[model samples]
Target: MPRFSANLGFLWKDIALPDAIRAAKRAGFEAVECHWPYDFSTDSVNQALNDTGLPMVGINTRLGINGIDDLGVCAMPGREAEAKGYIDEAIAYAVAIGCRNINAVAGKTGSTDEAEAVYRRNLAYACAEAAKHDKTIVIEPLSHRAAPGYHLSNVEKGLETIKAVGVANLKLMFDVFHVQVMQGDLIERLRATLPHIGHIQIAAVPDRGEPDQGEVNYPDLLAALDDMGWDGYVGAEYHPRGTMEQGLGWLKAYQ
Candidate 1:
């Protein structure tokens, strides 16, 4: 079975982040990832991880003023300074907390050449800075339906950006939920992108809730990863239908 990581961003939204880390451990998760934990002190988060013996796997850069709609400023033209600042802050925090991966949010843009250029330049900077700390930077492609103008809205663009950056540590975050919504060919896509996949995440289709009721067969997907000899955490980044425990019936099989 594939190792699982609790995405504390969605799995335990009611409690403090440090407590959520402990909850993930109590719930039998091997590791944990978060959307944003900047509000909490690094010392506290690190203490929780050390206490639980669970590695904090990933965390996103600041979303800035536009929040989810802006996603991130890294790819937004005329916001290079702000984007780099977010990347710098994320890298510093990741190093402090022993997290290896940072999701550098590529803010929404009009798919213009200028925007693409800006994204590549900023990503190159992020990759270089992250390299100093032995960190990997990942870019996620949001579903066009859910995030219409996001810069990295499809796999092709994600791959292209990585290629343009031309760095070893820059990789793609293969979020199955969004990939399924944007492109139906998961297996082939995974195969093609496996070399550059830095992390994987899962959620139900359409609803973005528990994976058990989704159109995608998560067991088969996990099996596919196993078959490919891909040993990495499949992040459970889904919103619970009820309490987190109530929606975790599907996790028993995986665990």
Candidate 2:
């Protein structure tokens, strides 16, 4: 069976981060991941994981200040320092939490050419620094509908950035929801990008809801992952249709 990591950022949103970890544990999740757990003390989150014996599969880098909607500034011009610092912070947090993956989002930019240039350079630096700690750095493609001003809106752009970075630690964070929105050939794209993929996330298409609530057949997709030797966590990242527990039937079906 495929290993599914509950994305605590979306799940258990009404509770504290530590309590969410516990909730995931009690819900039968062997591993978990989060968006930004920095609001609370790092030690508190770490203790929750320790108590539950649940591994944090991954965590994302700081998106940016409010109002700007900067999901990640790595691709923005003149924000290289901020981007690097955020990666440092994420790496420290990942180290403290015993997680090995950190996904970075590319912020909006005024210039696409410059953004790609800056993004590649910043990604190379992040990969180098993260590699020192034996950690993986992932860049995900968000759909324009989901993130209107985001820089990398498709897998091709993400892959181009990865190639330009020319580093082994840098990889793609493949999200099924976003990919399905931008492109429809999930299986072919997955196979072609398998070499550059570091981690994966999933949610229902069209509505950004649970996998079972969407048009995608997750059972076959997950089975494809196993057959293709994708030894990474398929992060359950989606908003609950009604309750978080109700959305887990898809995972249970696979198991």
Top-TM-score candidate index: 1
TM-score for every candidate vs. truth? 0.98, 0.96
Q: Rate the local accuracy (lDDT) of all candidates.
A: 0.91, 0.86
Model 1 worst lDDT run, 10 consecutive residues: 246-255
Model 2: how far is 246 from its true place, Å? 2.5
Over 1-255, each residue of candidate 1 has an lDDT whose tens digit, in order, gives 888999999888899999999999998899999999999999999999999999999999998777987888888999999998999999999999999899999878877899999999999999999999999999999998878888887888899999989999999999999999989789889988999999999999979998887689888888888898888888999988888888888888676
Candidate 2 residue 197 Cα shift, in angstroms, is 0.7
Model 1: lDDT of residue 104: 91
Q: What does the lDDT come to for candidate 1?
A: 0.91
> After superposition on all CA atoms, what RMSD does each candidate show versus the true structure?
0.9, 1.4
Candidate 2 lDDT tens digits, 1-255: 678899998999899999999999988887999988889788999899889999998888888764257777888888888888988899899888889799876787743898888888888888888888999999988888888878887898788888877889989999999999988789889999999998889999888888886688887888888899998788889988898877778776776
